[model samples]
Target: MMEPETRESLIARLPDHADTTAWLEFVQLYEPLIYGIGRRHGLQPTDATDLVQEVLLAVAQSIERFKPDQQRGRFRSWLFGVARNHSLNKLRSLRGQPQPAGGSEAFKQLDQVAAPTSLEQEFTTAFRRRAFRWAARRVRQSVQPTTWEAFSRTAVDCQSAGDVAEDLGVEIGSVYLARSRVMSRLKRLVQEVSGDGFEAIEGELR
Candidate 1:
């Protein structure tokens, strides 16, 4: 029962500087996913770190302007736009001819105009992994050590079930059983975080 606030409510509260709870939620949900996207797109570690800060700043400035469209995604689109914009600037800057864009207008324009293309896949992948990590962290602490290791070694580390069983001093059947149990719980947590499209994400979490 490690339920967290939904991203929509998290976004709703992000604008209030006084809401430390909301900001904490934002950091927990976003910082890693945004930073991971930056790295996967070929940014250096330092650049990825800067991308997180830059994206946050951009969001803080533009949060009020966000309008959720029934035909569109809310934060996913805005975040993808903001992250893409900053990431491109960093990449171009590395090449010595960066295009300058700033303020809420830059973000607003991108959010309004950018269709789910190019960076959209990156956004989705990073999002699932974020959900995975977020759920796994919570699940890990709540589960028994052997059970966690069974799931970790098999599902995460990709070790063979027999090997994991031997390493953990359990039967091979127990290994698969542990994995299934952990996976079931993990899926529930991920579904809560993702809110929809769990079918698409189900296979990827493994």
Candidate 2:
């Protein structure tokens, strides 16, 4: 099995155009979250798709200069800022609208008109949901079908343990054990996925 990557080492590989594995990994992880961000920010399907391409292109071009703030978080912090900027850019280019800002002007315009505090709060919530979904898919593949069903029905679907046990034809104690084991595994995988950003959203990741 391929060893899992941490955020720092993963970002280091991004600037290498020859590193297709790294690039594909990066896209698989962040594209959905950024696409969801665009949709939640009122973008249409086409616009959201364009926004994903735009943000991904922007990061690929600029990642050589990407710096993680020690006082802040890591690449995700910079990524979300870029996504928010380009998302606003896309919003302003709809029919009957002026051209969206570009270059350094985009940053200036974002500062001038964006309500970042609220928008970022919303984006962070969106990020958590996306992270959990990613973690669910990853963890499920590594565990038995019955184990995942137990956890999914109880923790995700809000079903009672007794009911899940009856339906799965397992003892109640097995349901309880599966729920505990799967949830614990999911939480660890989520921490790997979220990295530096995990602590900020621990309450919501559940």
> Who wins the lDDT comparison?
2
Clashes of each: 0, 0
Model 1 lDDT, residue 21, Cα: 73
Each candidate structure's TM-score, on Cα atoms with residue i matched to residue i, is: 0.58, 0.67
What ranges in model 2 sit over 4 Å off?
A: 1-22, 36-48, 70-73, 88-114, 158-163, 196-202
lDDT of 1 at 10: 49
lDDT of 1 by residue, 1-206 (tens): 32233555446776787888767767888888788766655666777899999998888887777776532565676688778778767765665434244332332332354354855866777677777777789899998999999998998789999989998898999999999999988778776666544455655655
Output candidate 2 Cα RMSD. Answer: 6.6
lDDT of 2 at 187: 64
lDDT of each: 0.72, 0.74
On a 0 to 1 TM-score scale, where does candidate 1 land against the true structure?
0.58
Q: Residues 153-176, candidate 2, lDDT per residue (tens digit)?
A: 998799999999999999999999
Question: Which residue pairs show backbone clashes in model 1?
Answer: none
Q: After superposition, how far is residue 57 of candidate 2 from its true place, in Å?
A: 1.8
